[model samples]
Target: MNYVSKMLGAPDISVTLARAAARRVYGHSNRTNPRAVPTSHRYRVEEVPPALPRALFDTHFAPLTERLPSVTYEMQRYLRRAASLRLAELISGGTWRQCATALAIPENSARQTLNVLGRAFAPDSLWPIFENVVDHIAQELDESDARVDYVKRRRLMAQWHLPADHHYAMCQDLRKLRTLREQSNPSPIEVLVWSAVTEAEYLHSPILRALRLSAEGGGRSLTLSIHRLVRPTSPVGGSLRLRPTD
Candidate 1:
């Protein structure tokens, strides 16, 4: 969708104006601009609350399995893998990581393994669990580098004249989310967004990228879901998809 369309759907004029102001700064000459320029208005996903992994497994993944036998089997595989990983983490801190007493595995190796799992065996949904042993296995919740990186990105956005509130509003969500994995607790919203966006190669806006998630089935056409957060009041989502590849 076009920028005007994205603005038109904003909750209010203030948000729309904030978005506009930020866009203007990002629209500067790409060659001269050091910051990444969003080529489109990225989808904004809704926020989810934090919850335990077993609770998440039941709430998020268990239901889908009921609808199809194939789904059930696939989910079972993911659970077993999670159980094994959790055990490994508990017993030896996972295959890549060191024992609880020593330094952990290289971030590169851990990230590579996460990437392989995500693209292939990563379940369509996850069972969020907090056991102190495997909570960190998910990796999305322990994003110190990502968080710091976005801080710099947001600073550039503001330095070029973007509204502080607009950026802060986003940072608040990111801050809350990055910390969710310490307990292996995640809201359904978090699982959904993480499943869709973790391996995305490109996004229109780096800070705003989590708001947009890439959706598709294995061997299925892709779709882009854009949404607004329901805020402290509730999570009755308002959704739009742009040029869905149906």
Candidate 2:
């Protein structure tokens, strides 16, 4: 799927252009020569509402843990083993910080433990829930320290149960969504909504019922078209070869 082909085929581009757009946004070396670059043309599509992103987050991303019981349970196991505390306690005020301070586990030791735990159990999908937890932890940290804390929590999650390349795929999806927004003339919020709904559908998320109802009330064809535009051709993380062999 080349960029031109994607632009021609659908009003909303797929990951190919998304990656290119990401490079354009984040990888450009010549900021002084902003005019040197060529921008994507706008397509006059249906207006995406401004409130879409918030609606999608509330509808799809927030309650992600509820859809994956097994993953949640595995997460609980790792949290307990790492902190010797329940999930609630780990999330409780000052407790996680205290645990981290008390253990003072070296990065190497933490990595090894995560690898061992990740290999101990195989779950169908882990990254989403892992990411959710990291975001949750980052919420408590200062903006300046949030990135550092996010990295630490991300490492812990990846070491514990995340499948290889899962994070990469997730990152690509985010970049793709951003790219799609840039290339199109839709509202930023609407682009987020499109990304969220398509992602929810791809994940078989619990919000499908809500989406279906929304579609039924609105128009079925529009929903179908939206799916065609942004839905991933491949599974988000590819094959989940989670279990390790001796």
Candidate 3:
């Protein structure tokens, strides 16, 4: 300090500071100190926020939910709200998990998500199909002379991934009421056989059959369905078993 005071007249000043002043006088102090933090550290690392895939959102998630616009729109709003909440939760910095958590969506759980999506993406409600079948099926068949169109039914059901099995079975029971009324001579106790022999022909079986492949493959493959806009039907035929191709 005494030597620096004598040299630069700045008593008790650091040698580096004294040198810095000398360099500044000649415009040479603009260079950073080697011992100091690097320029990289001065600039914070900025991360791009996680984005929901547009293709997946448009094709798989969006189109499937078109049938239930109100429900799906509400859900999307909730998810977006969840994402906003997660952003609020970030204290220091955000991570990928934080990003995913914000949207109330999981990451790297493809199989589970796809399975749920398969069920959630159902365009037609199985219960309604059953109800329709029960109410108008007899009339459509007997009075209206309309047979259960298996091709059209399969096409309709193929659009969904999951079939409401319990509900479909219940609808079958409702249909059997017609048969029960027509027994030739009612036995004291006759075993009521509710189409156990034709389990494949249930109302929702065709859709479940096609979607089994989708459910098994998880998120990798999407179900391929051909649909006609005909009114709902009392579906015929059994579970279709086919492998999705490459």
On lDDT, the candidate that comes out on top is: 2
lDDT of 1 by residue, 109-135 (tens): 333433433343323322222222233
Arranged by lDDT, best first: 2, 1, 3
Candidate scoring better on lDDT of 2 and 3: 2
* Candidate 2 Cα outliers beyond 4 Å, as residue runs: 1-77, 80-103, 106-109, 120-122, 143-246
TM-score of 1: 0.18
Better of 1 and 3 by lDDT: 1
Q: Write the per-residue lDDT of candidate 2 for residues 36-133, one digit (tens) a residue.
A: 11112121101111111222233434444355444442343343333221122223322222323323323333343345333432243443353345
TM-score of each: 0.18, 0.21, 0.15
Query: Model 2: clashing residue pairs?
Result: 114-159
Q: How accurate is candidate 3 locally (lDDT)?
A: 0.27
Better of 1 and 2 by lDDT: 2
